[model samples]
Target: MSITQHQTEAGSGMKPVGKAKARFGTGRSEFVVVAVLYAVAIFLTVGTATMNVQGKSAPGPQFFPILVCIVLYLAATLLAIQILRKPNVPDNTVHPGHGQFSADMLHDLGHLGKEEDAAYDAAPSQTPGKTWKTYSDWRTIGLLVGGVMAFVLLLEALGWILSAAALFWLVAYALGSRRPIFDIGVGLLFSSIIQLAFGAALGLSLPPGFVGGIF
Candidate 1:
């Protein structure tokens, strides 16, 4: 919010709904995402512990999974810290008083504040009111959900490379990127690299679709 806008709202006797955004850098939903990422990291770590090693000397299949989990943990911890540092100001209730009352009403502070609240409430807004839900981009969320579903259903048939590429492309598109060729190329490159690295380094086998021959 700009200085003038905030001043205007304050002048009108209205308290801002969310002031923590300045410190947190994001909203509650992002915190939930961080928590989910943290949980996934822990779960993956536990699963990796049970993986059988081919040899005691060399790094086992557990190495990559454990590494990934560590990265997730680090990311989650940073995000949690960011969210926790933000100071939240408690909301004060606005008690409306009759406009007929003067500055010396029954309340200790008097009716001045109450009259302002009543007037602000009664006035019609020049601009349409907006809430958190209004700001949310449901199209992006729907695209993400659809992408995940498609990725899951087509994983085996399309293989790790193609399925992952498609998922990445879908996510990029949802985020407003329009360069289809570049996005798909980058996604394909990344997916191919991951597949090759996991398969060649730790003997992890990913599903091989029809186009798997190129890799």
Candidate 2:
């Protein structure tokens, strides 16, 4: 083949890689899911929404959800546009690490025993790719989902305080919290504050369960 013909044939044979560009923290799939969920929530909100009869100017029940939906939709749309415009570059830096909250707590708590510290030290450099086929940690995702499901199942029985505390602790532990004592303490404290803020200040009644009198 002539040089120009050979070059043309080679160029024709080469295919461009069509990778989807996404934000650093969030993937395109995640963005799509969030957008869809927000849309679903908006629809659900619309179905049961009612305007407040107590006051003439009171915002309808669906207003907040609609507003949130709009914001989420805008974000998702922007993300989609960006993805379509820019091709995704392979990222080696996108390795799994201990959850930010848990990692910070461990840092603040100082060093533990040498044995525990040794084990803990390895977590920072350990990539999910070492054990898993993909960069994303399905184990962490499963644990998070299971924790949320457990919280939902236990919520009515255990009440907001206990359930929320358990949920917080479960998430922290799943994310590699080294100090159980601190995790539990922080969870309880955080849940209590949330209860106070919502139940007491906002007058939003939360399930008190067996400990109704205490709260």
Candidate 3:
């Protein structure tokens, strides 16, 4: 074939490939996902904020849920804005030689390559760095659970003051506290404050057990 004829054929073949890339790019897919997430956040915020909580306290049942919904809405809005501002570039051009098939196959298939495969190959390796660390911290979690369990078991028999004090010390030690004198003092202080606030001020009747007459 002559040079002019060969150049004309090559240019005609590239036209379909360009059109396919434009049809199914990453920008369109990301926009759709972000939009859906934002819609869900708005629905949750509006639905929960309007619900009534029948309790006589500063923070009723509805307080925490409403706070969480507001946070979700704000985060989703920011994500959507960021996605909108990002430039839309053809996937194949961004990171060359990463797609499942060559440019010739994409032109012949008349479709943009699967965008997710390209994204996955482009992602950075997640191999741990010097800052990374492993943990065998089940002992800590177990100690905390045991402490809470002990409090629940002893509350009715030992009273809130003794039960809560023991729980505080156990949990503090589990969290790596070493000073026994300070730990015990802090535990006593915490239990006493809780007794005063919940039992006396709030009029919530915690089990008094053996020391029922003292308080």
User: Best candidate per TM-score, number?
Assistant: 1
Off by over 4 Å in 2: 1-27, 40-44, 51-135, 213-215
Q: What does the lDDT read for residue 89 in candidate 2?
A: 41
Whole-model lDDT, candidate 1? Answer: 0.75
Predicted model with the maximum lDDT: 1
The sequence of per-residue lDDT tens digits that candidate 2 reaches over residues 81-184 is 77655644433322234332333344567533456556645675554434322366788889889999999998888888889888888888889887888888
Write candidate 1's Cα lDDT for 61-168 as tens digits.
Answer: 777787899899999988877767753322233333333333333355553565576666776363234221124588899999999999999998889999999999
Least well predicted 10-residue stretch by lDDT in candidate 3: 126-135
All candidates: CA RMSD in angstroms? 13.5, 11.6, 14.4
Candidate 3 residue 177 Cα shift, in angstroms, is 0.7
Candidate 3: tens digits of C-alpha lDDT, residues 1-215: 69998899898885533554434445544566566667776787777777664568665545555667777777767777776666444334322333445444565776545674466466635322222122448999899988888899999999988888888888889999988788888887987787776655545666787888764
What does candidate 2 score in Cα RMSD to the true structure? 11.6
* Clashing pairs for predicted structure model 1, backbone only: none
> Comparing candidate 2 with candidate 3, which one achieves the higher lDDT?
3
lDDT of each: 0.75, 0.65, 0.68
Stretches of candidate 1 off by over 4 Å are 1-29, 87-134, 213-215
